[model samples]
Target: MRPARQTALEKVLPQIAIESPEAALDFPFTPEKVWLEIGFGNGDALAHWHHEFPNTGFIGCEPFINGVSNFCKLVANDDLKNIRIWNDIAQPLMAALPDASIDRVYLLNSDPWPKKRHHRRRVIQQESLDTLWRIMKPGALLILTTDHQSLAEWMLEQTLRHSKFEWTAKCKADWQTPPEGWLTTRYEGKGAVAGRSQVYLTFRKVDCE
Candidate 1:
């Protein structure tokens, strides 16, 4: 992290850092819903969502030091009070959170791990989906977006195989276009500039007895 970013993180850590799962977030107002964004690169979407939905509490997880610093800077500069961050992988954090606590989850433009051997390392795996299902409320939305064709197919296949989720797309346009109130991210912009089209997949958590 840069010196300025380090300093910024230091000042905002106490307020935005999620020290432990046991610690309750002190939101300025009672949030009607809670959202989680995994691997929020540079936090562009997270910040946009926070700005758009001020009453919804947001928890963002990013293992990269630079990304965390950038998110912290956004939180500080905007005085965003409804956001918390986990500067680490999301699995453990998801485990610690109360069951069915999260209303929505965003996994956008995640690392594709294009090589065949490294597909196991992709974020949208069976185990991770189980964890996500455990944390998400019934009928909650799990939004996934990727510019990589292989990754988009992999995500759809994995989620479709999981009985807990249902694809919400009615037609090709639904998956090809951005959803309502969608916020563009830096990575998505790069993909667009490269003439690579993206896919937006939304899955709903099914109510299972």
Candidate 2:
């Protein structure tokens, strides 16, 4: 990591880090709504949302150390207060959260895990969806974006088949176009330059348990 990033981690991480799953729900600052971003690669979109919705609390789960460091730098630079970092996989935090806790979820540019055998490692699995359904508030939005064709289709199919979520797309253009206030990340930009078409899948949690 660069010197600034390393310094940010040392000085800022402890202030905002979600030390445990139980600690996730306890925010230092009150927020009207809470948003979770799973695998927030490099924290570009997460930081954008935190800036855009200063009153909305944000929880970002990212296991990659470099990504965590980059996000720590953002927090330090911005002095962002309504965000928490879970420097690990999301499942534990999801499990620890009370029912209907999260207001929105972003699973953007997730790892494709393309190989047939590695499909199980994908984040949009049935078990993950089950937990998401339980934790997400009714009518909460679950947004997923991917440039990988196979992964896009997989995410759409998996999310569509889940009974608790309702697909919000009215037509093909809905998925083809980015949602309002979208933040194009580095990976998404690179994929666009490579002539890859991106897909946006949005689902609303309905009839949550």
Q: Please tell me which predicted candidate would have the highest TM-score against the true structure.
A: 2
Give a tens-digit lDDT track for model 2, residues 97-188: 89889999999999999999999999998889999999898899999999998999889889888878999999999999999888899899
Candidate lDDT scores, in order, read: 0.88, 0.90
Question: TM-scores across all candidates?
Answer: 0.94, 0.97
User: Which regions of candidate 2 are displaced past 4 Å?
Assistant: none
lDDT of 1 by residue, 1-209 (tens): 78888987888767788887654344667789999999998999998888888889999889997988877777777766888888888878887887888999999999999999999999999999998998899899999999999999999999999878999999999999999777889999999999999999999999885
Q: 36, model 1: CA deviation in Å?
A: 0.4
Q: How close is candidate 1 to the true structure, as a TM-score?
A: 0.94
Reference-based lDDT, residue 101, model 2 = 93
- Ten consecutive residues with minimal summed lDDT in candidate 1? 20-29
Candidate 1 stretches with Cα past 4 Å from truth are: 24-29
Model 1, residue 54: distance off in Å is 1.2
Among all candidates shown, the one with the greatest lDDT: 2
